[model samples]
Target: MQQRDSIVETRSFDHVPESERHGTVRTQVQFWFMVNATLITLFTGAVGPAMGLGLSWTLLAVVLGSVFGTLFQAFHGAQGPHMGLPQMIQSRVQFGSRGAVLPLAAATIVQFGFAIFFIQTASSSLAAITVDQIGLYDVLIGAVAVVLAIVGYNLLLRVEKFASYITLANLVLVTLAAVVVLPIGTMINNSAFEPVAFLAQFGAAATYQIAIAPIVSDYTRYLPSRTKGRAVSAAVFGGTLVSALWLESLGAALAIAMPDSDVITAIHDMGDSFGYGIGSVTMAVAVVACLITCSLSFYSGSVSFLSALEAFRTMKSTGKVRSVTIAIGGVIVIAGTLLLPADFLGAFTAFLSILGYFLIPWTAVNLTDYYIVRRGRYSITDILKPDGGIYGRWGVPGMISYALGFIAMVPFFSTAIYAGPVATALGGADIAFAVGLGISSCTYLLLTRRRDFSGEFDAVRAAPLNTLGEPQRSASASTDSMEGNIPV
Candidate 1:
């Protein structure tokens, strides 16, 4: 058997070594399953219908959107082992090392925003149990999550695996509650498809899944390099798809059934339905689910923040300050949630909508650049030391393409804050995601069209394990590794 990398993952910014790449595909399945199976998703699930989509149509929209979005998330998940770097670090290949910071910062916000949303949702739901001690409840959940994240990657995976198993079973109670409130027949036969609402619902659902794109590789990077991409991708998609569909559908069902139900009311209603021991278990799962939700968001956010800024490079990338960063970030998110402008659902929906637009094109470009353009080969070692990674300081095409994608979405965007002119023309339908994905991907494809004839493959190779900070000496570095000469 191959030796393990370390008892714990010590190096954060560099390529994870082969010995360290000891996790199974099941890890990917469980980590992301627990990541998505949370109370906030249930809230996200309800937003689509609240936006005016019919329950039946909203459910379909959620499924279709989640499946399509997870395609990107799963693809990103597979890169973990191959590149042995964080997802944004691999992005340095598409957008140069320095250029990579844009997505990194954006992802930081996305993660922080999500952690905030989960805290607010969880705290609100616990009002019945805590009876007026809501602040204590919020702080306690956030504190536990920070501690879990501080314990670092292995513990995060372990907790998530356990959480996934328990949540899956406990979700049955939530599912049963849903069926009792809204029957299967009602979901299937009612066909009131509002296109605008359906599209918004789809965008929101897709955004929720895709927002994880920036950090997908964080958990997956521990797998062996030879691990089949299909396995990694399948594990993530299956777990995430099933969990999201269940909670999202459940949320939509309850929202439709009790249009006036608050977060606490929803939980109380479910618990009341199963008044025996099962009721207490259901309640406990809700609380645990809250910790799981914040743990992941804060965990990913902490890593993303540490890796994005060069100032933190001197600090040990792994265990040292990760928890500290997460704790500080958690407090900020909690404070912001309380001080924010609107209700939890309102603020969160807007946050998701805004984040989705930024993420769509970036994921599109990163995936296209890796799988299609470069066929997954990258200058792994060069990505470590920022002096002169094979990606160079900036790739005009990537930076320009990212901006163009964002600009293209302006007229196509649909949100509570602002609806673009095109979105207004389309009767408020939000097709920004589709437009941004296609435009950024097509633009990137066209710009790099010469790769088929160019000797670009000469510069595409993996770095040696644990050789992060050393000079770039991989086989790929022998070629003109810098992308400066690649004509746009």
Candidate 2:
């Protein structure tokens, strides 16, 4: 096990490296619990109600979307131990090594957006706690998260373990406070189903969960190689879902109970519901929760950026590469934050809808390729190699499916920037996310001809290499079971 003070993390790329894979499965659950049980999530959860779903339907959308989205995210996280690669890089088996860059770039953009989104969330939540110091709060939270990411992964795991407990308790207190003062009977009487609004919020809620797919493995990669895929999946699913449902449902409740105000304002009012000191404490805790989520945002943004470029492929997890990645990503996020509009609720919900448009197809294809087709086996060497290496630099099949999926769902996508005719016709409901997932998954399955079950789980190697990264004497029983013959 590497010690807590490993500075080599500065030069590392995405993966935790074989020598540093010392974390326990328990840490995986804790990391996610901390990641999901935070204010960004609370802000996101509240978006459905803010979208005009009222309370009842908003709550339903939160449950449906949270469950649906976390399935992909948790399953993706499972691949970390098996593949020893970050989530986006694992797509190389299907998209080919160089072609994989397309998705990597998409994932990076999502991460960058999320980093900014949550900072906005934090600053606003902080503004309620402090006296209109959102700018200072934003910079303060970003700097701390950047430093933590630069410190690297092991220390993060430790901090997250502790944060899980603190975050959960803080949220529970907020929930209780809100519930005690809320007029549930009146809010329930005011509730009624809005299909268009329900689906719109559903997509946003699910988008929040699925967006984590690109980064979940960044934390999961430290587990032992033989970790059970089912266990990893369940752990991630349980942790993410529990918190997502709770905070999001709470957000929905706040949206209805305090319709005139946004999440930040609602939260601030909740503090005011209690005495001033208690209110101040609750709001301050929310700021801390935002800070925790930002740490995750910064760390994963760095990992996604490094994973996109081939130059950082061989670097250690704690080396100069990682430090530089964090520093650069932080600067970009800070600059973007200053430049982008600070309409927290407006910007936050809008980004999620746009996010779903991208995530649905990518998550569909990646999950389909991994679990349904390949059954999770992948050749680490082939993934690292460049052009014509089994999965080559540019595989057209996966690329085509991804494009068609995007085109297929464009009609149902609804965003402030662009709304599809279908979305507009359906009273602004956004069903494009589901359409893309179904279309892409089925399309990829047909294109691959059920290759997942055909023993071609990952890229085929012309010559087998032993686990030691050296030439092997012969094929293993398991290797022989794999389909596809390569001439050596």
Candidate 3:
């Protein structure tokens, strides 16, 4: 295993060799647990009560949505170790080398969008806790997050592992305090469930979890190939689900008890009600968690952007490339945070809904291709081919299925900007994600039925080559090669 003490990760958009693979499945648990236990997820939970669902119904939505969404997202973790490549790059198998630019671009936008949201919320929390200068906080937080992203994988793991303990402890204490002090019981007893609100909240919760799919593997790709798929999937699913539920449930209760205040204010007021410096501590922890998640977004966004660039031309995956992309993305995130609209919660809900529309179909097609049709068989050499190797220049099946699935969801989309006719008729309940997932999966399966993979499997068995088309050397001898640029 390579030394984990390297300050900056050297590899990006390249296959991790067995010699470089390190880390245990437990790290996956810690990383995701910390990632989800943040202000963003708490806001997601608050969406239920904001939409008029009672506390009981909101909790139901949170549980159901987290379970359903995390199941699909967790399976993607297995692909990282098996392929030894970043998540979006692996899409080349289904979408073809160049054809994958479509999904890569979409994934990049999602990552950047997420970074903007995290920074926006964190800036607000920081301003509320200490400084009143939201703009200054935005720049400071964005700069710090970009630096962490530049340092890359190993450092992210260490930071998240340490953060997992702090976040978990804070959440447990807050949950207990809310239970004893809030009017959660009254909110539950006076509950009036609306189907539209229930479904909308459910969709929001599910998509909040699903949004992690495109980037989940970026953090896990360094794990040794022998890591069990089930073990990785279980760790990811359990950790994310637990943190999301704990925070979201508390968020729902907070919304019920303090409807006029924002999530940050509500959390701060709740902590202060206990009469120690707990309010400041909780706000500080929330900001720290948000910053960590923002760094994750920038890191994965850079990798996805580079993967798109590679589809157009061959380029070395150097540290310089990663740094440039992250720096550029960080600039956009900071600007967006400053210009955010007044209705933060409403805008955020719409953003999540739109995210689901774009991502659900892609996830469905990618997962179906990985688990069913291809069954973990792929060629690193062909996937890196400029013109695409055995997979061809464009995967007609995947592209067509993705488009068809996206089109199928149009009538069911519900948001403040536009409510589709079907959604309006159903009293504004959005079930577009479900429809997209079903259509994308079945369409891709049918389209690829007669396709043959014998040649692809043969290519997989052949000796892999680096981007220069030379036979690859052993990981130990090629430690300084463009593909194996691990710093000593």
Candidate with best TM-score: 3
Give the alpha-carbon lDDT of every model: 0.72, 0.70, 0.82
Task: Estimate the lDDT of model 3.
Answer: 0.82
Q: Could you estimate the TM-score for every candidate?
A: 0.88, 0.89, 0.92
Give per-residue CA lDDT, model 1, range 382-452, as digits (tens).
Answer: 56656435567687778778888899999988778788999998777677887888889999998988656
For candidate 2, the clash count comes to 16
Candidates 2 and 3: which is better by lDDT?
Answer: 3
Instruction: Say what the RMSD of model 3 is.
Output: 5.5
Worst 10 residues of 2 by lDDT: 465-474
Model 1 lowest lDDT segment of ten: 461-470
Tens digits of lDDT, candidate 3, 290-342 = 99999999999899999888888899877777888899999988888888774
User: Candidate 3 — which residues are off by over 4 angstroms?
Assistant: 1-5, 339-345, 348-352, 463-488
Q: Pick the winner on TM-score between candidates 1 and 2.
A: 2
Order candidates by TM-score, high to low.
3, 2, 1
* Residue 439 in model 1: lDDT: 88
Per-model RMSD to reference: 4.6, 4.0, 5.5
Q: Write the per-residue lDDT of candidate 2 for residues 1-488, one digit (tens) a residue.
A: 34446654542333344565677777777778777766556666665566566777777788888898888888887777766666777777777767777777777777767778777777776776558877777788888878877776777777788877877777777767777878766776777767777877787778778878878877787777667777888889988888888877777777777778776677667757854455566667666666767767777767666666763344444456667777888888877777777665465657655754666677788888776666555556666664525667776778778878989998887777788999899877667878888888888888988344323332232234312222333333355544322110
